[model samples]
Target: MNSASSIQESRDEIVPSGPLIRLSLWVGDRNLPFWVLSIGMIVMLLWAGAFKMTKPGAEGIIPLVSNSPLISWQFKLLGPYMGSNMIGATEWTAALLFIVGYARPKAGLIGALITTIMFFITSTMLVSTPDATIAWKGFRYMNNLGLFLFKDVISLGVSLYFISYYGRRVMLDEARTDS
Candidate 1:
């Protein structure tokens, strides 16, 4: 082979086109992608909930929760420590349920629905959080914490998607079993 031909052959041999693409395609097609996303959400929920259970974390959020009309009653009823722990417990419950959903299709759909509601509440944090949209400090768009909460909207949407996806699979499986 000529030098140019040899170089072309070497280039062709060196390039890898299929592995990443194939892996992504496989993940997208299978339940693996949903599980992957669920794992991510689980981590976030577990971390946030566990952290909120800590004294400092609970104390830090006291004002924020206390200020919200929707949740303030809880704070008043439970006090800061118990109130934060309650929220943390709720988060942990969601995470645990989400994990179980991995093995059980119907349960997973329920988990996804729960996640959608949880994120929906967090998304509302944009409105309830006092410093969510700090502007004078040059915070715009997602420059502030409020803007950061916007991602929950996407998370909520993904949870809803999982519900539809898993719900259909579960229903189809049930129909097959019945038939």
Candidate 2:
């Protein structure tokens, strides 16, 4: 066979087939992945916000909140339960925005921005919270609290993605109407 045909054959072999092709198509559609990410963020925010409103949850975050320069004032001003409740209310608002954003890209953009700020703040707890890391020999490893805070890094990335995607979508929609 000619080199061109051999290359084509190899390409065909590498390409997805059968059920894999269908799965690939589903992922490639963009909407599925976007909604999946949106749902995940919404669920997390709602659950976490609800938890924070509770006394136990408020107490649980005391150490992290106390150490945080950005939010420490809240604890002092509102005290533990009230301060945590305020944070929870913010989360609930963001979650509601995400739900509304499904129908409106502008709302989604706002939600994404809120989520970005929230995750960024939480991620910082890894550095600010004492005992977040454990020293073993020369290397530092995350403790349980550190591990918990580290998840915020992933959430931060997701929020950023939502921002970019929704931002572009909103811009494109506006451009279409303007033209």
Candidate 3:
């Protein structure tokens, strides 16, 4: 090989792979991925649920909630202000249960189920919320409402993972006890 070509090859061999590759490998670890997902889920739930507890934050979602047929009865019976409070309370309760899951497997399993249901309901907003689509770059696309609701897909996936993992753990414990 020519001197320049040999030097380039040597440099390539000595240098490490790109960070993205390294990160992919690191996250590919079975346990690490779950822990990362769990931490991210916890942060998102805590932050979002905390906001739901506040007046401004709770009020902001009124239109969306009111529009949803599945939940609009809450708005009607409780009224906007009180209904918002109730929704906030529900979110906060689910988030707290998820936090407790870290220490208690049974509690964690219930939290995971609650979280899964919450995300599933929110994800349905893509259909229930009005004007969920918009024209973007001459192509029809999800509007902000759709975009906001669509992120529940990730949350749903994470919740399912928690359910499967914790559910299995709980079941195994039960079986061991029975035996």
**Candidate 2 positional error at 146, Å:** 0.7
Total backbone collisions, model 1:
1
| lDDT tens per residue, model 1, 1-179 | 66657977885576446889767656755868677777888898899899999999898777667667667788899888998999899888878877776666787787787778777877776778776765565654444566567888888988898888778778777978999
**Candidate 3 structure quality by residue, lDDT tens digits, 158-179:** 8899999888778777878999
Q: Return the candidate ranking by TM-score, descending.
A: 2, 3, 1
Q: Positional deviation of 35 in candidate 2, in angstroms?
A: 2.0
Ranking by lDDT: 2, 3, 1
The C-alpha stretches of model 1 lying farther than 4 A from their native spots are 1-24, 136-140
Candidate 1 vs candidate 3: the TM-score winner is 3
Deviation from native of the Cα of residue 177 in model 3, angstroms: 3.4
lDDT of 2 by residue, 76-177 (tens): 998999999999998999899989887788998998999899899988988999999999999999989899999999999999999998898898789789
The local lDDT score (0 to 100) that residue 102 gets in candidate 3 is 72
The alpha-carbon lDDT assigned to residue 49 of candidate 3 equals 71
Per-model TM values vs. the true structure: 0.74, 0.84, 0.77
Q: Can you give the lDDT of residue 70 in candidate 3?
A: 83
Stretches > 4 Å off in candidate 2: 1-23
- Which scores greater on lDDT, model 1 or model 2? 2
User: Which has the greatest TM-score?
Assistant: 2
